[model samples]
Target: MCNDEDTIKELTVGRRVGFYKVRGQIGCGNFSKVNLAVHALTKDKVAIKIMDKMRLDLQTQWMLSREIFNMESLYHPNLLQLYEVLETPSRLYLVLEFAGGGDLHTRISSGGKLSDQESKIVFAQILSAVKYMHENNIIHRDMKAENVLYTTNSCIKVADFGFSKRVNNRNQALDTFCDVWAMGVLLFFIVTGTFPFHADTVAKLRQSVLEGAYVLPTWVSAPCQRLIRGNLRSDAHWTRCWVASGSHTTASPTLTPATPPSPPICVAWQME
Candidate 1:
């Protein structure tokens, strides 16, 4: 648990942290909170993830280090950009690109289900990003709607690398199949605005997912239903082929690569 002083420091707003002036809290998780901040010099908006050092156990520390290393090594338009890393005696901060349009979960929850074209547009970006990660031997173990962010222009930005892993070889990374499964789940959520699997308990949920049982509404298009079914199949080999073929036929028009943004100035500061 964080002490009184540490808690105070975290809750305080408008204070400067490194090169950015912190603002109101935007989001929070179990051990860390994200704040919206602006760079003092360039005035660019950024999300600063503040983590309490005391709250991070050894396992969490290793995961944090892996997340940072994986993020720093990646350069993709659909992936979140990590601009800087800062460390202090009591806290650690990660300066990241800010996505003003909120996350996929919130969008779906607020606006109801997306139309066929809209779902294709969003899923295409996610497919491109996941394809890139697999090609680079990185597996995003967690690929839910919540981890998918949108920019002001509605472009997809996959974030949260805490569960990501870099394998030695792309072929050896069977976990990529799990990512394929997640893509199926995400696609279902995008079009239907609901999870494919539903259960009141964790065990039942696991069983539901494992059984791969879900019904598509009659309003869903035939091609879209086929794509979702292919992705959620038990055979990993067939699922991969289906994704490759279906992505082209379904979302080809909007599957064009996003232009990479200019690199940000990287800097680090230690607090006394």
Candidate 2:
């Protein structure tokens, strides 16, 4: 029921979102909800993202359509596969690949700190997909852990590009930065097992993000040949600053919060 756990909650008066029989609600939020559904004809399982037209007018709807279009056009193991779209009078249905491992957040929450090598592999896989999207002129503005899904093969697939926009020209900078910002958040959550920049209040969260303050442990700095390690020259520069500030805003920032409390010293990754 993890995917279609919403068998009990009431939804907008209508039949199941699409051909997939409603197993139950997977998850829900302000903008949309996910349901576990099975195909009526093939009996194949899929996750359906149900969004109400009433919530979005022309602009957002167009953006969502673009996201769906982007997913539909791509064929990558690291990206969530989009099947088809089914529309009704009240809501729009997006048929998607059923990823069973769940989002990266669930894995990080239950798996604990990943190894440095593990982090490297995970980040490399993610970067590969992002690089592909970049070449395609698409920017996944929201790249946090919640938007990433793990396939049964232990592969991390980037999903949920609702906040993304395509940038065809080099001059397009607006809204592009949010994508990397979301990545930083994904990293923070992966290592810390917590939303490093999370806040209970909307206004408060906004204020904190603007502060550009976040913290990580100095010990997490493993000796490396890359750019990530060299940046942490002193205590105040990276780890200390973030722990004191509570938000990380740096691009390519070497932010890897305090070490795991204790667990045979797990390998830390670019978590989220």
Candidate 3:
């Protein structure tokens, strides 16, 4: 049934979005909604991000196209894979890999602090993905726990590129530092089950982040603390601040053979 607003109370469960059949709504955001869907021919489960074109400005539409193009061009095991795009007169649909394990935030919230091995695994995967992106000159401006998804194989996939941008050079100062800062925050959460900077209000949280005001728990191990603090340092040239000479060979012996070497590149300094 349609509501007074003339919108359906819920999108038809079996409605087709491109070659996928929508099973149900899985998530929603300010300008879009995501549906759990399955391939009509292959029966493969996927997540489809549906955005109503009528509600979007031309610039927003351009951004969406850019995101799709970026995702389509990039391929890494640790990055969420985008399969197809279906653009209609009224809407745009993006077929993406369905992460059955949800996001890292949900896992951290429900399972408590991650074991050291788990932390190492996740950190390794994300760093590998980010390093690849950097090598390709793509900066994932948005990197947070909510954007890191876990797969059925216990591997993490870096998701979301709405804020991503391509640059001519990664050196000479770049906004990718924000990504590094967020990675540091994710590392802190994995070890401590909480953010390094927290406040009741968004304004206060922004202030805390800008001022680099945060406390590290006494219980965290020295190596872990060093890793976190090294990335979360206060440096003007964040891209050049990674300790150990921006090496990725720091993987602990506990990490599995399948895991990528520890983040060898520079993580970055605090954000403004």
Candidate 4:
């Protein structure tokens, strides 16, 4: 059990919490925090995400609930594994698989565009995960490079399902297809070495996404187009690198550490 009287600063870096013991800080947020934790007995590493009730509203609460629901309903290797959840009077806890490689956005920002084979391998795993989610009636509404993470084995682990939606038919434009659009955006970043959806502010970015006015810049390959257009439906297989949101080509540039956007609220989306 968590102690209500324990202030955030007083929380030790290695204190035991429930089945897992805190190892160190892995992530931090305004309302909550994530820690690199370990299974008490097994000593296995895990990522613990804590959501603060005090900082959340009813709508945010709903998003968190839906994300957990979607994760509970599906299983796939490429999808981030959610092992257990613990609730406290003041917070909600999620114990998830540890991906030490970190979010894909981090890798792309420092490494620039990945090679075609690397892109293919990564895309394949994402496709598999998306296909599995679709089969189980789930849609990943906010798919993006930052939301896409990787395991230590270099396999894909699509993270963050907060924005995912459920669809009964192919014709509807639910959050799931929006995730597909986000996926296309991510692929554009991976292949092109830049964010496909360029905007100076959040409101503008949202407008661009809703309008679907994404235009490809020069350097995007023809096959990239096929990838984006083919998989925006429930029946479609998640294959190929999509170029729907932006061009897959970017000017040759060196990479530095890049600052990424936060995950989309009510929509678990993020960009590198």
Candidate 5:
């Protein structure tokens, strides 16, 4: 069983945590640190987020509980998978699927903005994951590029549910609309390599968000521009309908030579 002594040892490299062998630190937060590990039996890689019980305030504890509950309830291809939860008197460990390809923020910073086709692929997976979450009554309040991870094969996996909540009422416009607005910001960031709303200070940023003023890059296609506009606008219901219908064309046919395509495909709905 896990004890305080074992928890201290687990923080060091080359220590065992239950069935997994801890390797090195991968990531961290205010009260938790994530370590890379390998399963002893299956030999599969995983990330173990170790949280100190003493550091968690009452509010943080409540958020942590909600995160665990939401993650445990979710089972989607594009959502990060929680393998198991282990606890000691001092620390709590969350075993999760390891995404070796890094996060979307790092990817964009290192390689610049994604191409139209590439953005469509990545955004479709994110959209799919978000749709699944909303359908299940879960709201991922924190939806940003940093939380979007990639597998070794380049598949998208949405992570970080600390700000997430499950609501009993699906018709709650305020809650769901927040996600829609975030989706718009995410799309704008991936396509242009910048946030749609920006300011020097927090107060100014809030004002920018309230004003809802942003200019689409000239390179972005008309349909995608329309989609982004629809998402950021006051009509959250219209944005939902557009996303649900999956009809917006992210790529512009006019930009390229007019050649008959071999097969018709809906790129927005293609998660894989």
Candidate 6:
């Protein structure tokens, strides 16, 4: 149970909430704030996402509901785990798995492009998570580097389901393809150290994305280039080309904190 009178300030460091004690702040978004907390009895570290229900619109509420629904039903090692949920008159609380390595976007921003093998390892985990979601009838509409997080084990965990949706029929294929396009964008960043589309404004960015005009750097491996081409252009070719190419033959293995070798083996249909 949660207290309606417990203000946001009461959620700061040294404050107590239910069976958890707040340690410090984690981060904040438009409608929610995250805090580092510890379970009182077990002393287990966890991240608590606190969303102010008063600040959310109907659409945002719907998204949150979908996020909870999707998470409650899906379970994968590479996917961030939702531990518990709590509610009050004014807020919704979600206890989530803490990922110490932060997000892939931050890593890429600090350390240019990753090596081919490193990119492959990270990508394989991402594909595995996406494949699992699709198989479970969920489509992560917002798949990007920022949403891909790393845990203490150095394993990839796909986070954030606010933009995710559950699809039951073939009519939702295009929406799912958007994820493939986003994956292509992420892969381009990992392999070439840059986004495939560049624009000064949102309109221009949308235009660039629709055009799918990107220059593949020479250093990128041939197999990766093929994957990018199949994804960045012609949504129709994405599934077919990836499958026919026989590149999805790798399995995701646990990667050590050392230099990596060839990428993981995966299939195209499995990736989707």
RMSD per model, one decimal: 8.8, 10.3, 7.0, 9.7, 6.0, 5.3
> Would you list the C-alpha lDDT of every candidate in the order shown?
0.80, 0.61, 0.74, 0.66, 0.79, 0.74
Q: What is the TM-score of each candidate against the true structure?
A: 0.85, 0.66, 0.82, 0.72, 0.86, 0.82
Clashes of 2: 20
> Which lDDT tens digits does candidate 1 get at residues 1-272?
33466644644434988678999999999999999999889999999999999999999999999999999988887899999987766788899999988999999999998876667667777777788888778889999999999874457789999999999965677778888999989999999999999999999999988898789998887777777887888898876665444343442323443334322111111111
Model 4 C-alpha lDDT versus the unseen true structure: 0.66
lDDT string for model 3 (134-188, tens) is 7777889889999998775357789999888888755643666776777789899
- What lDDT is obtained when candidate 3 is compared to the true structure? 0.74
lDDT of 4 by residue, 159-262 (tens): 88887776677445344545565666777777777864558899998776556556665566666654553443233223222312212233111222212321
lDDT of 6 by residue, 25-45 (tens): 888999999998889899998
Residue pairs that clash (backbone atoms under 3 angstroms), model 3: 246-264, 247-264, 248-264
User: Which pairs, if any, clash in model 5?
Assistant: none
lDDT of 1 at 194: 94
What are the per-model numbers of colliding residue pairs?
Answer: 0, 20, 3, 2, 0, 7
- By lDDT, is 4 or 6 better? 6
Q: By TM-score, is 3 or 6 better?
A: 6
Model 6 misplaced regions, further than 4 Å: 1-14, 170-172, 240-272
Which sections of candidate 5 miss by over 4 Å? 1-14, 243-272
Ranking by lDDT: 1, 5, 6, 3, 4, 2
How many angstroms is residue 227 displaced in model 6 relative to the true structure, after the best TM-score fit? 1.5
Over 4 Å off in model 3, which ranges?
1-14, 200-204, 236-272
